[model samples]
Target: MANVNEPTTNYVILTPEGVLHGFSQVEPSEQQLALQAMLAPEQTMTAHEWVERYSEIWLDMFIEEGWVEVVDKAIIAPHVQLDDFLRYVSASLSGSRRVAIGSDEGFCLAKMGFTQQEADTLCVAAADFFDFLKRQQQRGWAVHGHAISFFSTIDMLMPNTSFIFLWINNQGYWIIIEDEPLLNNRAFVELVWGIKATGERFNLLAEQVLDKKAQLESDQQAQAEEQKK
Candidate 1:
């Protein structure tokens, strides 16, 4: 990583179009400066490696909650430690997507070519949760029909990390949370489809998978019980 304050050494960027070189300038615009930082990994990582890095972190979250399974498949043996995976997929997928991280610190997304495995894993998860989300939606979770485009999901790839994403349309809005995937298998789905969730690892994992209706119902029940006391 090069300091923005000083000149960055020669670097490359893996963009949606293709791999590109950075432009040398006496004073790069603010956007170019920011872009240099965003493309940091490309200076070292190939497109496939970048996607693998992101997927590994995202999968680790699910692994913690027993939502996913991992087979080493390494020629030698188990190579995946917390930081290292023994065998890595050699090919990068054809499509491109942006993965960004958010917190009090700030926000950043990696622009890279995604792998097929990465796309499949998320698609499967999103489809699974979409079933539950559709059920809740019919019961008035969203505006009944907001014409939302289910493009791609941006998982907040940090453990015990909390993030807020707001989607606004002509009809209404949705506040989606993507926390560690311990609540339920559908957590990845919910996070993918922009469903409301209590992304709290402190609570029982079962209790954490509350759709909008479930969450509201639980709140009402708690309020009623409190009144009785």
Candidate 2:
């Protein structure tokens, strides 16, 4: 049996052949097992089964360690910013035709080997398609209710390019490549979680600023009233 008090070593590697390998000194817990099952190509457990087996405490630890993020009562996978996340994605999808990051508001944050105008156009198309998907769900056409991640091979906007779309918080990311997709890749999953965590941090900072401004305005109003009295 492994010593409970002794430190354990865990490592993950992405081989040049694109195979992912992971190892741990200690046996995985039920939660870890459940997560692994969910990550499998032929997922072993349903969402409900996975939820039942998953541990909230484990999730809390991931959040505390900045591996996961919570935003507006929803969880965004991996905690990372736009720039760093893009870098990781770019490296993972090396030699891709184009890789772009954008928001639902038709704003392109960054792109590789593409003009700003082209990026913007792609973002708009993604946003429109996302909206259309939601509308279809509302119309009962989508029996699965909603999807957190999806892809499109038909490039209606950009010719000769296929793209994958991932939604992180209120933002969207696009990876345009010929035949490779990052939807199930470890790097892509990390990008999603990291971006969500970044968004949460920004929201908290904005809230603090707004609260401080409100307090200052109240203090000034009190001082003026006292002087008038």
Candidate 3:
């Protein structure tokens, strides 16, 4: 991987989008810079391979006590690792209705409506005990609601380490302590969404799916009315 301070030897051609010209090229941001440094060369990985490798690293970092299954189909951009994940959390999802937390050692993204103290408390809890997380995971408790976002530790230079993400949503709170967070966001959102959008991954397809479902329901209703006629 290239040093963060070193410029490329040549102006390797890139698209108008200004994405990097190297393997696993993403947007040219600090997160991408860090990611390019930390990750295995993209030439050596397929998309699926990236996901699997990320999950493995995450498990090693966070699975102190319980079993964790990375929901691959549920994530948007699964290629993202730790640094990219934190950039998303700190810059993107910080103030949104949902909360997200990310670090190089481990990353956590959660939706939130909790007070700052509550949020801080959750962070403390995650930082303090590995067994507590395990019990909650085994009980199948929801971590996404109104609880809090938590990040136990932050270590920039470490590899294959651990972190925690607490995501709060309308439904509940969710805690993900993995080696990395699946940091996904929209191009427009990353540039314009501001601080609150930082930590969690976003899915453009989720919105599309919701629209499609609504259209299907409308079509069904129309068909039913025609049958009555």
Which predicted model would earn the best TM-score? 2
Clashes of 2: 6
Pick by lDDT: which candidate is best? Answer: 2
Instruction: Write down the lDDT that model 3 would get.
Output: 0.33
Q: List the residue pairs that clash in candidate 1.
A: 79-86, 80-85, 80-86, 93-115
State each model's CA lDDT, in order: 0.30, 0.49, 0.33
Q: Which ten-residue region of model 1 has the weakest summed lDDT?
A: 82-91
Tens digits of lDDT, candidate 3, 90-121: 43333332333322123233323445455455
What tens digits encode model 2's per-residue C-alpha lDDT throughout 1-229? 8788985432221211111111110244444333333332221233334445666566455445443322222222445456556665765653453567666556777676567788778777767766776687678884231223333545443234455454443345544443243444556555444544566667888999999999999999999999999
Model 2 residue 112 distance off true place after TM-score fit, in angstroms: 1.7
TM-score of each: 0.18, 0.53, 0.23
Ranking the candidates on TM-score from highest down gives 2, 3, 1
In Å, residue 115's CA in model 2 sits off its true spot by: 3.4
Clashes of 3: 36
lDDT of 2: 0.49
